[model samples]
Target: MFDIYNIGSLILTLSILYLSANKYHRLLKLERLENAGASPEEYNAYDKRLRLECILLIVIMGTATILSQFTNALTVAVFMIILGIILKIIINKCCPIPK
Candidate 1:
C-alpha cells in the first residue's frame, strides 16, 4: 500500500538520483572543456558547484536508500532503476554535447 511517506520518499529519491547524475555529467563536460583549453576562470564556478552538488546528492541518495529499506526494498530498487533511465533522458535534454 502506498502512503504519503512512501510517495514522498520515492519522489525525493528520484530527484536526488537525477541531480547526482546531472552533476556528474556536468563535471565530465568541465573536464572536456579543460582539455580543450577553455580558461579555468571561465569554468571554475561551475566546476565548484557541480562538485558540491555531486557530494550533496551522494549523501542524500545514500540516506534515502537506507531509509527506504524500511518500507519496501524491491519497490525502491525498481523505482531507482526506472528513475535512473529517466535521469538519462533529462541529462540528454539538459546538456546536449556540442557537435
Candidate 2:
C-alpha cells in the first residue's frame, strides 16, 4: 500500500541520488584536471571537499531509506526534513566551491 511517506521517500531518494551522480561526475572531472598537472595540495583539497558533499548526500539518503521502514511515518518525515535542512546549512558553511 503506497502512501504519502512512500512518495516523500521516493522524491527525497531520487533527488539525493541525482546530487550524488553530479558529484561523482565532478570528481571524475577533478581527477582529469589533477592528471593534467594541477597543484597536488590544491587538487586534493578540492577533491576532499567534493567527497564530503557526497558523504552528506549519502547520509541523508540512508536516513530517509531506513526511517521509511519504521512505524512512525509522521515522525520520520519531520525528522528527515529537519535533518536535511541542518545538513544543507552545514554543507554551505563547510563546503565552499573551490575557485
Candidate 3:
C-alpha cells in the first residue's frame, strides 16, 4: 500500500538518479573547462548556473512526488524514477553536456 515510507524511498531514488546525472555533467564540463584553460570567472558562472539547475531539479521532483501522492499513483512516480536513470545514462554516454 502507498505510504510515507514508500514515498520517501521513491524520492530518494529519484534524487540519487538525477544527481548522478548532474555529477556526470559537472565532470564533463570540468574536464572541458580545464582542457580549454577556462577563466575563473567562467567557472564561477558555470557553477552558479549548475547550482540553480540543481535547485530547480529538486523542486520539480518534489512537486511531482507531492502531486503523485494525492493521485495515489506510485506507478507514475516509479516511471519518473526509471526515466531518471535512463536520463543519467544518456547524459553520461550520448547527450552533450549543456553549458
Top model by TM-score, which number?
3
Which segments of model 2 are wrong by more than 4 Å? 1-26, 35-38, 71-81, 95-99
lDDT of 1 at 10: 73
Listed per candidate, the RMSD to the true structure in angstroms reads 7.5, 6.2, 7.5
Please give the clash total of every predicted structure, in order: 0, 0, 0
User: 1-99 in candidate 2: lDDT tens per residue?
Assistant: 436677577757776777868777877879797788877666866777777666766677667766666647787778878987898788768766555
What is the TM-score of candidate 1? 0.41
Tens-digit lDDT track of model 1 for 8-97: 677577776788778679968898978888765657655665655555555546544664756677766776566656655655565444
- Each prediction's TM-score versus the true structure: 0.41, 0.49, 0.63
Per-residue lDDT over 9-98 for candidate 3, one digit per residue giving the tens place of the 0 to 100 score: 887888889899998998788779878988776776676666556655765586578668777577767766776666556444533334
What are the runs in model 1 whose C-alpha is more than 4 Å off?
1-33, 36-69
**Residue 77, candidate 1: how far off, in angstroms?**
1.0
lDDT of 2 at 9: 72
Clashing pairs in 2: none
Instruction: Using TM-score as the measure, name the better of candidate 2 and candidate 3.
Output: 3
